[model samples]
Every structure is written in structure tokens, then in C-alpha cells.
Target: MNTPPSKDALREFLASKFAEAVEQNPDAVVLYAAERAPDPKRYVKRPTVQEVAFKRELEKMRDDQADKAAPESATSVSPAIRTNQLSLDDYPGLVLPGKHNEF
Candidate 1:
């Protein structure tokens, strides 16, 4: 299948053609329409099999990277450890015993 020319390539072609037309007719000003004429076969390029394969490979790599970057589910850790709240047992010696007589 043939693909359309990129925006940059079309812009360059238009600019070059406009410059040429202005150079040839310095005395008269005109809106150049000749460049607007379309040739279906001129601007499109066919993708080769190797190029298509490379594109698929790149897309697959991107998907893999996205999957790897996602957050892991809570099931991977120990069931005793809740995912949200911090577990006091994990840090020993940080707690103090409650005093009954202190005001």
C-alpha cells in the first residue's frame, strides 16, 4: 500500500515551486496554482516487508515497556501486610507501653 507524503516533504515542494515561479515572473504577482495539481503516484511510497517488520517490533517493544512500568498488584506481597496501612509489627521497638498512672 502507498502512503501519503509527510507534511515536511509537501511543504518543501510547495516552497521550491513558488520560488521558481516568482523568479521567472518578477514583474507580475500571482497566486501560484500549478503546485496544487496532484499526481497520485508521485508523492506516495510503498513500505517494504523489512520496514513493516521493524515497525511491528518497535510497537511490541513499546507495549512491553509500558507493561513493565505499570504498578504491581497487591497479591505479590505477603498476605499479612495490608497494601494501604503500615504494619506496626514490621518495625520493632518503635512502640511505647501505655502508662496507667501518668496524668
Candidate 2:
């Protein structure tokens, strides 16, 4: 069996595919797809000193929003894995027909 692609490899493959699709079908209405963000240095104009300060303050304001273990973006990148904590309480009708009416 073929091994699964690593996350980075999958992302690169997707980015390339999207680029191709856009090239072939610029008029296509894409519903959902992940495209790599363009390089800020190449695309974005250099910010003024005042704009830089404003950006920093905006980031600080976003960080101040109500108590949370981490930013919402943090969990989305790599979600935590949790196991189901099943217990007898989950099945009140299950019984082996022994002690206390159950074995």
C-alpha cells in the first residue's frame, strides 16, 4: 500500500493544483480550496512607520479578546486528539445477568 502524504506535501500538491485550475478556468467559481498566501514582501507595499505601529496595536487588541487557552487559529492548524471515555453509565440496559442483577 502507498504511504500517506505528509501534511506539507499534501498542501504543496493542493497549491499547485489550484494554480493550475485558476490558469485553465479563471471564470470557475471556486467554492472551497486552500491557496497558499502570496508573499507579503513581493505583493504588499512597504508600510509607513505609523502604519507599522498601527498594525502592532491592532494585533494587541485582537490578543486581548476574552480568556482562551490559545488563539482559535492555533487549534485549527493542528487539532488535539481525544479518546472517548466510555463508561457503564453509557449503557444502562446492558447486563450479564449475575450479581446485583448483572454479571
Candidate 3:
């Protein structure tokens, strides 16, 4: 009695068969299915310097507002919206380029 073929062996056999079928019939649409690992580089969207600065400024503002609203309960707040203790810094992106500067 012959033992069953392993998954890898079966996949190889099927792939070869599909390749042969395509070779034999030029017009045939034989789907060659294979699982591929995700490429990390393809999924990454690196933020610009300006974008990073803007995000930090926004977080700092939120923390400041939260602190002012509830000084006592600020420490007792949930983990998600907790302050990151961001330092105050100049946000050039937040300022408008005009004679009357706007934030």
C-alpha cells in the first residue's frame, strides 16, 4: 500500500500539472495558487518630519486640555487617553505664513 503524499509534495505536483496545462494550451487560464509572505516595506508609510511634529503638537494640546479639565481625576483616567507628557515646542506647521500670524 502507498502512503498519502505530503502537502508540499501535493502542491508541487499540482503546480507542475498547472504549468504543463498552460504550456499545452496557450489560451487556457490555469490559476497557479501559492501563499506568499507579506513584504514589510510594502506596508510601511513613513511619516514626514512635518507630519511627525504636527502629531506631537496635537497630542500635547490634548494632554493640556485634559489636565485643565480634571486635575484630580487626570491621574485616575483610563490607560488609552493617558498623557504622554509631551514637551512644549514650536510647531511651524501649525502657524500660518502671513503678516498677522495665526496658529
Candidate 4:
């Protein structure tokens, strides 16, 4: 009798099949699939003088902002609307009540 294929073997087989499918249909959408990894060495470096000037300007602006206390209006948020607006019980077409439901 033949034993079942391992999870790793199944995953690799599926990946190979997916790659073959992509090759067959070039226009097919696979948004999450990353074809290649980015090379750090190929990245362009920022100019040292420009970076220093930018840091100095940012520090000066931060110091100025710190000297003057932030207004209450800037920090305060309106409590009219709350997040995660839909409660699980209130959601329609629930497979099982008191459990998570798809949006």
C-alpha cells in the first residue's frame, strides 16, 4: 500500500502547478505572489549633506512645537462614532450566532 504524501511535498507540488499555470496564462492575476526579492545593494544612498540639513531643520521644528503647548482641540477626538461598528449579534446571515461572521 502507498503512504500519503507529506505536507511539504504537497505544498511544493501545488507551488509548481501554480507556477506552470502562471506561465500558461501570463495575464492571470496573482497580486500576493512575489516573483523576486529586492536587492539591498542596488538601492541608491541619500546625500550626506542633504540628510544632515534635513535632520537639523526637523529638530528645530520639533523644538519650536515643544515650546508651545499643543491645543486641546488638536488632541481631543469626537466620541460620536465608535469603531468595529457592527456587533456580531447585530450582523445578518450569521452561520452560528455569538460567533464571528464574514463581512
Regions of model 4 farther than 4 Å from truth = 30-103
Q: How well does model 2 score by local distance difference test?
A: 0.73
lDDT of 1 by residue, 1-102 (tens): 999999999999999998898899876674665667665676668899999999999999999987875645524554346555566566664565663345
Report residue 95 deviation for candidate 2 (angstroms): 96
1-103 in candidate 4: lDDT tens per residue? 9999999999999999989988999789547866697666876777799889999999999987876646535656433323535554454455564566557
TM-scores vs. true structure, each candidate: 0.31, 0.27, 0.30, 0.29
Ranking by lDDT: 3, 1, 4, 2
Residue-wise lDDT of candidate 2 within 1-103, one digit each (tens)?
9999999999999999998999999987557788899866656578999999999998887877633646665656332222345545556766545645423
lDDT of 3 at 67: 78
**lDDT (Cα, 0-100) at 68 in candidate 1:** 76
User: lDDT scores for all predictions?
Assistant: 0.75, 0.73, 0.76, 0.74
Candidate 2 residue runs with Cα over 4 Å from true position: 29-103
Residue 48 in model 2: shift from native, Å?
54
lDDT of 3 by residue, 8-59 (tens): 9999999999999989997899478797977667567889999999999999
Question: What is the alpha-carbon lDDT for the whole of candidate 4?
Answer: 0.74
Compute the lDDT of residue 88 as modeled in candidate 2: 56
Which candidate should be chosen as best, given TM-score against the real structure?
A: 1
CA RMSD (A), model 2: 32.3
Pick by lDDT: 2 or 4, better one = 4
